[model samples]
Target: MPGIYLGAILFSLVGMMLIDLKYSLALRVAPVRTTLTVLISTSFFLAWDLVGIATGVFVKGDSPLFVGVTLAPHLPLEEVFFLLFLSYLAVVMVAVFERRAAARRRHGGGRSATHRAPLEESA
Candidate 1:
C-alpha cells in the first residue's frame, strides 16, 4: 500500500509537469514562475496542515505506504505531497475556468469600446 501511494505521488508530479508545460507553451508563460507559485502555495498549505494536525482536527494513521517520518497523528511527508497535489489541482482548475470565461467573452458577450454610446454627444 505504501508503494502504491508513493507511485501515485510520483505519477501526479509527472502529470503536473506535463500540464504546466502545455500551459507554458500555449500561453507563453514561464514554467519557473508557475513552479515557484506552486512551491509557495504548498508551503502555506503545509503550515496550515501542521497546525490542524496539532489541533487534533484530523488524525493521520501509520501507513507503510508512504515515505518520511510520522510525527504522532501527522505525517509531514504526506502533508507535503498533499500540498503539491492540491496546488496542481488548483492551478489547473483556475486555468480551465479562465479559458472558458475568455471563450464566453469572445463569443459575443464581450463589450466593444464603440458599443458604449458617448455620455455627452457633440452639439
Candidate 2:
C-alpha cells in the first residue's frame, strides 16, 4: 500500500519503455539526446511545480488515489513518476512520428527527390 501509487507509475513507465524499444524509439534511436530531453524536461516541470508550491499557488490534495507519500512538504512521490510519464510520452510521440516519416520516405511517398536525371539529359 505504501508504494501503490508509485508502483503503478513505475509499471506504466516500464511499459512505455518497452514500447519505445519495440519501435526503436528514444533510447533506441538516440540514447544520449533522448536521455537529456527527458531529464531536462522533467527537471523543468519539477522546478516549476516547486515554485508554485513556494508561492502557495499549488497545494497537495487529499486523494485516496495517491499512496500518500511525499518528497517534500507538499510534493508527492507520484509527482516524480507523473513527470517521468510526461517526458516518456513526449519522447514516444516524437519517435513515432519520426519513424513514420522515415518509413514513408524509405518506401515511396516521394522518390523524385532522391531520383534525379543528369542535368544535360533532362534538357
Candidate 3:
C-alpha cells in the first residue's frame, strides 16, 4: 500500500484522458489552451498548498499509500501528480460541459419555459 494512492490517482487520470480522447474535449479541440489551463491551475494550487504548509495547516498525514517521497518539508511526490490530474480533469470537464451546452443550444433544446412563447398566452 505504499503507493496505492498514487497508483489510483494515475489510474483515474488515465480514465479521464481516455474520455478526453474519445470526445476530443480538451487536447484535440485546443491543445495549447488545455495545456496552459492545466499548468496554470496546477501551479496556482501548488502555491496554495505551499502557503498552507507554511502556515502549518497542511501537515503530511501518516498514510501508507504515499510513495515516501517529499518535494519539500510536507509536500509529497503524489501531490504533484494529484494536482496535475485535478487540473486536467477540471479542464476536460469544462470542455465537455461546454460542448454539451453548445449542442443543446444548436438543437434548440436549451430554451427554458421563461424563454419560450408562454403557451400562446393561454389562447
Please give the CA lDDT of all the candidate structures. 0.70, 0.86, 0.92
Candidate with best lDDT: 3
Clashing residue pairs for model 2: none
Estimate the TM-score for candidate 2.
Answer: 0.78
Per-residue lDDT over 33-98 for candidate 1, one digit per residue giving the tens place of the 0 to 100 score:
667777899989877877888798867766777775564456546667767888877876677787
Which ranges of candidate 3 are over 4 A from the true structure?
A: 111-123
Sorted by TM-score (best first), the order is 3, 2, 1
Q: How far in Å is the alpha carbon of 7 misplaced in model 2?
A: 1.9
C-alpha lDDT of residue 13 in model 2? 92
Candidate 1: clashing pairs of residues: 2-65
Q: By summed lDDT, which 10 consecutive residues of candidate 1 come out lowest?
A: 24-33
* Tens-place lDDT digits, model 3, residues 1-123: 799999999999999989999989999888999999999999999999999999999999889889999999999999999999999999998987898999998988877666767675565
**Residues 4-102, model 2: lDDT tens digits:** 777888899999999988878788878899899999999999999999999999899877778877888789989989998999789899888887899
What TM-score against the true fold does each predicted structure earn?
Answer: 0.69, 0.78, 0.87
- Clash number for each model: 1, 0, 0
Predicted structure 2: clash tally: 0
Off by over 4 Å in 2: 107-123
